[model samples]
Target chain A: MTDLTAAGRGVRRRGPRTRWGRLRERGYPYALLSPPALLVLGLIAYPVVLVVEMSLRDGRAMNISAIGQEPWSISNYVDVLTDGDTYHSLWITALYTVISTFLSLLIGLGTALLLSRDMPARRLLRTLILVPWAVPGVVASVVFLFMLDGSYGVVNWILRSVGLTEHGPQWYFDPSTALAAVIAPTVWKGFPFFTLILLAALQAIPDELYEAARVDGASAAARFRYITWPAIRGTTVLGIILTGLWTFHTFDLIYPLTGGGPDGATETWAIRIYTEAFSFFHPGSASALGILSVVLALVVVASVFPIMRKQFF
Target chain B: MNLDRRQFLHRAGLGTLAVAGAGALGACGGGDTSSDGTMTLDFPTWQGDEAGVKTWWRQAIASFQQTHPKVTIKLQQVPFATYTDTLTSRFSAGKAPDIVHLPTTTFGSFAAQGWLANLDDRLKGTDILGNWTKVQKTMMWDGHNVGLLVLGYAPVLYYNEKLLKDAGVAVPTTFPELIAAAAKLTSGGVYGYGATTTSHPGTYSEATWMVYGAGGGWSAGEKLRFTDPAVVKAMDDYRTLARYSPKGVPSEQKRTLFFDGKIAMMIEGPFVYAGLDKAAASVKSHVKLAKAPFVQQPGYPSNSIHVSTQASKKKADMAWEFIKSLTTPQTQASYAQLYGVPSPRRGAVTQAMIDKRPELGLFQSVTDSAVDATPDNKDIVTNFSEVQKLIMDACVRLQTSSTPTATVMADLQNKVNGAIK
Candidate 1:
């Protein structure tokens, strides 16, 4: 047994398998990866450090010169946390993210499943579903503005003509419906991303599994539960995670739609950060709010990712 | 040998990258002086190509260049919405233009930060300085002459003659008469009043007219008293005016609807006349302009152009000369005619201008009485823009929600007090 092991060790140390070759193999992936790693360090990691540093300083109204002159303290974070507006904005952000992400994912999953099947005009429908995604966020929001206008909007006109009521709902003016109104356009613009990801996952599932299930006299629902859901669950979780993060940071769509007005009905954390930084000219406060937002996002991903990994993987 | 080759290529690539990055950054530092020894000055204005004003600016620049051959004026135009933010960013980066168009409300904040050059000594004995109006006194901060008003206009009543006549309502000259006319004209798809009652910045200016007219103002001395009984009453009156308006419509949309004849009357400035010619013929024939119906005092919602402190002394003098050229009688007349707004000079409105557009006469009548809506108390209010937003938020709350006027006013007063503190 000792002789056999010695022979195997000698075979492993053949020509061209020298220490330099082993070293190159170990360093090649890292060498290829250094450019992207440096890019992330410069663009993402460095800005994050700056944001944390700015939060600790006393900079307001583009007055960054006060950084060293003023004492570095946690006063900004304290003020933001103690403020009533911060809680209100965070609540709004939570509601907006949860609803928008769920709606976007649901619509995406349904459309992706439908498109995965062979149907008439499937190619054309697949191409056309991405129209909203193709349009820029600001342009999409503007189009929705005209479509939902109280006086001249096509939506109100349609609802009125259908005998829904004497007058259609004042979608933006009423706080009750304003959030839903804004979310409608957001989900519309975001669903196409999910559709693309989920559709690719759906198509990757083998045909033989479904055939075997059918042979076993399994119902369509059973076949879907066993074959389809398992096949696409991992992609679905990833799509939700991404869409949730994007929705949490939704600013461009909401800013033009309501401007965080109608008495702060739709003032998300992103809008609050903008108002603090640009409108109020308090960059320190804005940076504190930004760090809080990042922490919250990480907490959400941390809690959700583990469960999702275990369930799907 | 292979390692040496890889290291050489890496260092070479990095050197090239560093050189390229430095070149790009150096390009952003701005223009160099001409080899012929002419100084180039940047003059940024927010008016852009609106209402044929670009042509007026071009002619004014050409005239200035003819007189000052050693100076070159680079006229830059930024959009009105982002003008202040852009200027502030440029100022922070030390890349501010030699001259800037400073809106009256934001001048205090910039001047307080020492961004604007004082023109006191330069304009002391000049005829241009002698033409300064009492309203322009608000532009002064810390006992220095900071800026000069280039163009100014106040809100006035604009009505469709056919809509008023068809509704059998006479022209209103009082608050009651205007409210009654709006109620009468509320039938059909058309609304009588078209005030931009939203939380838009334009609404703040529009609402200030009512606040001032009601004997309510943003401040008395250095104390900002938004809870002043007069202000609460003014907000109540404003809420009534909005009831007759299409809810949540912005100023631009209001203008479109007014041109379409869906809105019978709107409180707007002389700039509205520029688009009158483009309105439907039916709407055009019925257009009428009148002074604001209920007003004891005129609101000064004017913007001025000023020399930036970042400019060299020599460049600043050139900028001042360019600004002075814009106010010359000839340039002012062309500005009023082409831009359809009142000139800042005391007697810049000529009979020829009135003949060209009769409605401009109404704007001219109010120029002498115009008062800065939120007059700055240099000791107390450091950021006029923040104060303006607070007041605007109060106005929006009162207009859009069922919040009690007194409650909103008290909250606003506390907020303003805190901001100033």
Candidate 2:
């Protein structure tokens, strides 16, 4: 990852050096590139390969050095797939990932539209939207949990006050709604990134496109569908991909809120991996599961990549 | 930031390390932790208590330095939050703490991973485990001593005397009496009962107390008979208490309601006593640290349950020495004096703790009868997470609508049993 970032930095450092004509300009490229490369190789590549190796191997994490004595088995992968619980958790995770991503994008797009438009206090609104990210996941979970509290939350208060609800919602406690409670915070913490990315893309679009639509006498909705969306669809795909990745590994929101509870109503695969590996100390199995998650994520990216790439135009 | 060829190379290399190793380096304190003499200990405690713990350790280590002084210990307390993730990275990197604090439930897996030091020789030679209970003995994993009771035994209830007083009640002797007291103390706004049910100490703290208190024994039931009536009764009682809870009974959040005077009564382990005293001056005056009330059954005596602090066996010798010294009457008494925690050792919870904090008298009686939260089984504790999830699910369903409580209860029981097998 740093390699990619460093590649970007190399251009910045060298391009400016030649323009400025400094003595060390020639060396700047190597100077800028070498440190990060060597460090990444030493620190990242070594450990990651070790992890990838362990993922393929059949032993537990703590017993890594005991490789020869311990039997290497394919059972870990078998366990990840055949374990009734794993299958359940994967489905739950997939459901969580899909629902949370969709909801977050919708919420984020709405907010982006509102904030990117000529609204009074747009500065404050944009800043406020970003505040959820600033709130720690656990804290955000607590606050959201409190707000939608079945017995004592503010959401119920507002709802009942307006006669929308007689009592507050039992967000996490109710299985029917518990999954939603976990997803809400993901949308909250993460919508801002989506908004920022999409809005930035919107801003970068040439204003003349909208003007051209107006000159062609297109309806406001038509112009939005034609010019506004087509221009920013690429950024939206990227934003959703990023958010999807974030939600895929999301543990805190689900953990604190529901703990994947109500008899597995909200137990995402991440929570399952935690309970199995960390809580249960099933590392070999857990690592195998972890590898599965990475594969699942890659499959998602690979599936989405072609669509996103084509949309880039 | 101009760099000569070599310097630029070095800087670039370091930068790549910073990025490529973000998770690893971030997992470590900052960057490379391969320093020859320097060691990083991943001490996981409660999430928000890192700073206070660090500060306390700095003083404690400084004092310990008065002894041999040659060794430098960097006591890094991972933030109470993110503790699991922080440790997972360390474990993955093979960079776990030289010393660690393992919870009883988590010890099974950690030991299975060979994350724990075999403290067998350490415990066999030392008198530290003397004050420890045989019931707590089940916490022993793979027949090797993984961790020991370092700080808390378990938390019981700390009630607001003023709130209980205004409600015109003494701490109840039985579960029914306890319920009445809590119910009366509870208004529409003020919770009758307070519990720290959050995952860390509160979940274990109160869950252990309640399950044991209800006399739903943790020993294996007849083969495959996991859910007994007692277990159901215990779950029912917990669900009842959850109804009267302040702030929806988060494992850790109810302390706020208790401290804020919104809760009439709440159960906490010894861990929060010091912090509570700081929050409420009236609590010091009127805060009643009592054992959890017994579950009421006809012709049955009120049974108060014992709560254990999460245990650890990370620094085998040092941890045991600390536990042994702490449980020693003198050390326990000294610690009780320094921090308001009662010495968990029955003998060590002397008359002095009661004299200094008279509220401890209630705890003393409770402590005498306090028992272990059973099944210190690795499978059980690992499954405890599943249990909590199942119970919480039932809790959600029961609270959501007027569903048949039995359906919810049965579903939960089945889920727990399924996880265990």
* lDDT per residue (tens digit) for residues B1-421 in model 1: 4558679869878997999899998887545455677888887777667666777888888888899888878878888767777887787667779878877767777887678888888777577767755666766777777888765566788899999999999999988788899999988989999988566777787778888877777778877757788888888888788888887777888888899899999888777778887798878888888877866656574778889888877778778888877767778878877877777777777887788778778887766566666655553446566677777777777776788989998998887776665
Write one digit per residue (lDDT tens) for candidate 1, span A181-275. Answer: 88989999999999999999998999999999999999989998999999888888989999999999999899888877666778899988887
Residue-pair clashes per prediction, in order, are 0, 24
In model 2, how large is the Cα lDDT of residue A242? Answer: 85
Q: What is the TM-score of chain B in candidate 1?
A: 0.91
- Residue B112 lDDT in model 2? 54
Off by over 4 Å in 1: A1-40, A61-70, B1-32, B375-381
List pairs with backbone clashes in candidate 1.
Answer: none
Q: After the best TM-score superposition of candidate 2, give how far the Cα of residue A165 lies from its true spot, in angstroms.
A: 3.2
Indicate the worst ten consecutive residues by lDDT in candidate 1 chain B: B374-383
What tens digits encode model 2's per-residue C-alpha lDDT throughout B175-270?
A: 777777887888857788875433333444454466667766544533322356776676567667766774345655577667777788876655
